[model samples]
Target: MTRVKISRVTKVPASEAPPASGECPPSGIRLTTDDGDAAMGLRVVGIHLENCGKQDYSVDGYPLLELMDKDLSPVQGISIVQGSGGISTGTGFDEPARPLVLKPGESALSGLMWRNTTESGPTANIPYVRVRAKQGADPVTVTPQLDLGTTGKLAVRPWTRPSK
Candidate 1:
């Protein structure tokens, strides 16, 4: 899991600013990976977002999740499957904002799908998920590697979430 800080700008002086109510610093946000599944010539990658702060947080745009090889090159035939179908692959924006909200200590799950189109066999690559809380906020990228064994077909279970 990778932690990232949310960016905030305030005009109030540090001393004069209101004390933190329940909100957590951006550092409390985390990106994690679940086990992936490959079956019936299809690959499903599990992605997760964890909020460990005292307050809730929201993701502004489509969660940036990509499948890439060890050399950091985009893997062919892998694409993020958006359930909402509102945002296109390029823009990453929706007509109406569909922000994902996670309360403190809560986690959200997303999936990416790919088909093994090669004739040789199943190829091994890494799944990476990038997240940013708001526009102009610093983004964090987390890539966790899992071994699915050598086979032309693959099936991986999602990783278990850590206990609080």
Candidate 2:
């Protein structure tokens, strides 16, 4: 069985400029703050999934991605909002379990919104993120050393067809 891998997970700064027309961004993951206020405790995290295996792979239901804490456990009160319903770009509003096929060397981009509820500052404990192709598949967990400041609500987007 082929296994999907997490090539890289980057923290996109709000100050980063958008891509030029018809041009793709550098990192697969994009992070943006709501209301231009990173201190206000709202962030949007985007991810690009690359297929590095020799065989093709399939993903469904938001790619089953999760932001894990230091102990490899999912944070509390984080809501996963699947991008299957056209709520975001790339993902389509079709079946809940839309099969996203990825050939070798291909990649797909997805977004997730994180909202902080607690008054605590930055989650220094969170050091890694976990991802899987689908349910029952072996999850590929990696410590990208991402600093998710404090705890909050996370709305995840599903994996979709790669844009040409």
Candidate 3:
């Protein structure tokens, strides 16, 4: 099966992620929503992944999204991975999956939140993110690749700045 890379972005101020200690799914990734405390004042309005596609794959080894700072650097974060062609509860997004085989025009949507790890300060500045799909040598059929994230339709009030 052919493997491809998937990508996405978020423009809103990311909220702190809930602890992963007892919050993950048995089979899939775990995501906790910590609507940032009053200290940082960083509120996660919403996270939108536009067009997401994965090749024919299995649910065992799905791709994971790693958030980055304004410099296109990696920011420690957690991702919500799920299967393809399914609806994710709470948020109206698609479940991310592995070896995901998509027909033409099919896509998935993944949600994410940033957690505050630094002591007494604002959270990291997250502009864009990189989602890497691990590869496995399996005979599983796959689908065509699609784009992901806020496809140029982002609006972050009071936080928007000119791109570098």
TM-score top scorer:
2
Q: Which tens-of-lDDT digit does each residue in 1-59 have in candidate 3?
A: 99987675333222223223543222232222222222242222322111122323222
Compared with the true structure, all predictions reach lDDT values of 0.46, 0.50, 0.30
lDDT of 2 at 28: 33
Clashing pairs for model 2 are 62-158, 85-93, 122-149, 122-150, 123-149, 123-150
Ranking by TM-score: 2, 1, 3
Better of 1 and 2 by TM-score: 2
Q: Give the true-structure RMSD of model 2.
A: 12.3
What candidate 1 gets wrong by more than 4 Å, as runs, is 1-26, 66-69, 73-97, 119-140, 144-164
Lowest lDDT 10-residue stretch of candidate 1: 86-95
State the lDDT of candidate 2 residue by residue for 28-137, as single tens digits: 32222122123355445555566555677676666576667655567665444554222234324233546777776676656554544456565444555665555765
Q: After superposition, how far is residue 155 of candidate 3 from its true place, in Å?
A: 21
lDDT string, candidate 1, 1-164, tens digits: 99989763224223222225454445676654456666664455555557877887776544554344555455555333344232213221122334566788887555444444545556555543343434554455445452322332222222223245
- Candidate 2, superposed: residue stretches over 4 Å from native: 1-40, 84-97, 117-125, 143-152
Better of 2 and 3 by TM-score: 2
